[model samples]
Target: MKNRTKELLREGKRVLGTWGMLGDPTTIELAGIAGLDFVLVDMEHTARDLPTIEHMARAADVVGLTLMVRVPDNDPKTILRVLETGVQGIVVPQLETGEDAARAVAAMRYPLNGDRGVCSITRASRYGALRPKFAEYVESADRELLLVGLIETAAGVENIDDILAAGVEVAFIGRRDLSGSLGVHGAAEHPMVLEAQERVLKAVAAHGRAWAGLVPYRKPGEEEWITHDVPFAVYRNDISLLLEAYQNGVRMLGRESASAHGQGGQR
Candidate 1:
């Protein structure tokens, strides 16, 4: 029943996290140690298995980081697998309409709100330890566990109002993918992309739901999300950060070597 990410949002505090695309528990642990509020394990674009998510969720729990996972799609079975691991939130990708968002919500909730299959013998129910208090757990999980919808397409932008009405607690409009959907490819900064982002986010905020975005490292454009009053941001993924670090090291060495050669006068 502990959800630090939701608590932070309720407390009017900024919720910062990084993507866990590497499928390593250590990365989730490191994010927790680094003071992140959550770690969103990526299953949409990664080879992360269900057991890997369970392990990462375990690491996140130990470190007090709220564990969230992006399911490959809005499938009940997919959502069920992660929830069993005691993960606190679910993110459904390529969410395009209210029906899609509603389906995702129903996949996570227990009836009479949703139809998610029940099993108290799972980590989320304390391996049957909370079996006696299963009803309470169900209520708490339904009330607190976040249901996030990813808006990454033109259709999503057009239907944002409906999406919000469908009970998506968080609307994370992914600009990178939205850019591609809008025919901009990698131009997340294109006017069309930025315009659609603002449109969807404005609707998300207006509907009294939290909004999230991916902030680019060292880009002034990244600050727009903050200034626009977004409460959640994922500061790049672990893989991207590592790649940048390595690339920087190589660039530094090359610069140093070039400078030394210039000073040596063609030696």
Candidate 2:
């Protein structure tokens, strides 16, 4: 299957995707069927383990959905292990400086370049089916794999320029965490958040790299002026989207029932 995320990135078009915190293979499959270009298996806030993540990655691959795993920490072990699961990319969070971003890239590479240990029989190498040409696969993995650095904190924003120069293919703006660090938790539309986001975009653009982010909109009317030059966009998470729809449906039904009862009493 073609790497849709890479294709979109190369084409300079915005690739839309969302977070998959559910950690269920079925949920990941459904998300893939929904036509998202990619789905991030969130290990930071989710209870997903290595086995579960591997299952999710397979489901995504079956449906041609690019799987990107957000490792729990910036640790090298976590990064390399997750990559071995055949995920197309890695999203390293809480990146505070250029060195942090560089370390992530190094962890995802092999020796003589980085420290990713050799694994000729893992799922990433087609479980030894492609082992004969392991070197070829390794080279391709280096070119195809995406390294995303998530800039969320005030310090990260301050060091944005350096982070972009660290050879990160994409820099994601973690809006919620960024807002919290700026003392405007959940206020993604605040002037402070807007300014920080603009700074990140400018820095990323200057470095000729792509930027990805999520826009939190509670209602239809809230979708205004969010169009930036972001080449990747994650609209919402699965749980939040499900909860919002359920709430709206329940409220609408309740209101309809109340209106019917009132009409009958009047008659």
What would the TM-scores of all predictions be? 0.90, 0.89
Question: Which pairs clash inside model 1?
Answer: none
Expressed as tens digits, the lDDT of each residue in 1-267 for candidate 2 is 246788888987788888887878888788878888898889998788999989988998888898999999999989988988889999999999989988988898887668788888888888899877878888888878888888899999999888877777788888889999999998877899889988888888777765655553453477564657577778778887766676578587864433345643211
Q: Which ten-residue region of model 1 has the weakest summed lDDT? A: 258-267
On a 0 to 100 scale, what is the lDDT of residue 192 in model 2?
Answer: 93
Tens-digit lDDT track of model 1 for 121-150: 998888999888889989998988998788
lDDT of each: 0.84, 0.82
Question: lDDT score, residue 99, model 2?
Answer: 92
lDDT of 2 at 69: 91
- Candidate number of the best TM-score: 1
Structure candidate 2, residue pairs in collision? none
